[model samples]
Target: MKILAFSDLHRDKDAAWSLRDAARAADVVIGAGDFGTRGEGLADTFDILRDITVPVLVVAGNHDNLAEMQAANRGWPHLHVLHGSGVAIGDTAFFGLGYEIPATNEASWNQRLSEAEAEELLAACPDKAVLVTHSPPYGVADLQRNGRHEGSRAIRAAIERHQPQLVLCGHIHHAWGTKGAIGHSEVHNLGPAAHWFEI
Candidate 1:
């Protein structure tokens, strides 16, 4: 399958259009997260993204609320908004988890999950499924400007246990386009552009 994955659009209409146009050649499109800015501006990007006809999988970022996103995308059949959930397309399964894991002190509008909370949410993921998360697993594709690894330990533990086929995430801007590995899974930090992956 051909998958186009991206993240952190942050309400950039041009980027949304870019992804929409890029979806023409992809079988599936994955939006890792950050479609909004501090819980606002989601509609700006969604308006353009709504044009893509492919099966689009998305998760809410720290700047977004899951309920708000689901409500906004209620009528869209092609767009699958996921959080702590799993979906199957063809023969592959995709599991998604969103927001900043292990919590964050950056802003009050930021939605976060503690390590234990993340573990509980991630427990339902099927083994070897494609893992899509807003935060990268601890120490993998999660390096920051300060050289700190801000990923969730629970996420790492889950990766170790599940050994998924691929891990997709975006949050730490410095780690964009970078790839790492946990066990045998390929983890990528997708930025605000189209990344092609074949599975």
Candidate 2:
């Protein structure tokens, strides 16, 4: 299947329009998250992406409210807002885990999970499934501007164990569009621009 993936839109209408056009040729469209600005205007992003006819999968970024996004798209059959869950499209199994591992960040919209919490949430992921997350795995497309690798160790462990076919993530703006690997899995730190892959 052809997958079109993007992340960290942050309510950019231009990016959304571009993604809409890109989605036409894709079997699936995946958004890694950060559609809103500090948990606001998320509905606007959804409105812009409403033209996509294919299956739309999204995870909540640290800047977004998972509950709000889920509630907003509750009635939309084509859109799936996933968090620590799995969904099947055709024969491919996709799993999602959103937000960052909890830290003493000052941002009020920053949603997080502890290392153990993340591992527990990811334990249900099926082997070789496509993994989607808002934060990248440790040391893999997760470098920060401060020259530090700010990623979840639990997430890395999960990827190592499950060996997903592909891992999609965002949040490290400086590492956007970068690619890495964990065992047999291809990991990408997607940006607002659409990325196409055949899986």
Top candidate when judged by TM-score against the true structure: 1
For residues 42-88, could you state the per-residue lDDT of candidate 2 as single tens digits? 87778889778889999999888888888867666688988989899
Report the number of the highest-lDDT candidate.
1
Task: For each candidate in the order shown, give its overall lDDT on alpha carbons.
Answer: 0.91, 0.90
TM-scores, each model vs. reference: 0.97, 0.97
- Give me the runs in candidate 1 sitting further than 4 Å from their true place: none
The CA lDDT at 143 in model 2 is: 90
Worst 10 residues of 2 by lDDT: 100-109
The TM-score of predicted model 1 comes to: 0.97
Residues 7-56 of candidate 1: C-alpha lDDT, one tens digit per residue: 99999998898889999999999999999999888888888888888889
- Residue 168 of model 2 has an lDDT of 97
Model 1 gets an lDDT of 0.91
Model 2: runs farther than 4 Å from truth? 102-104
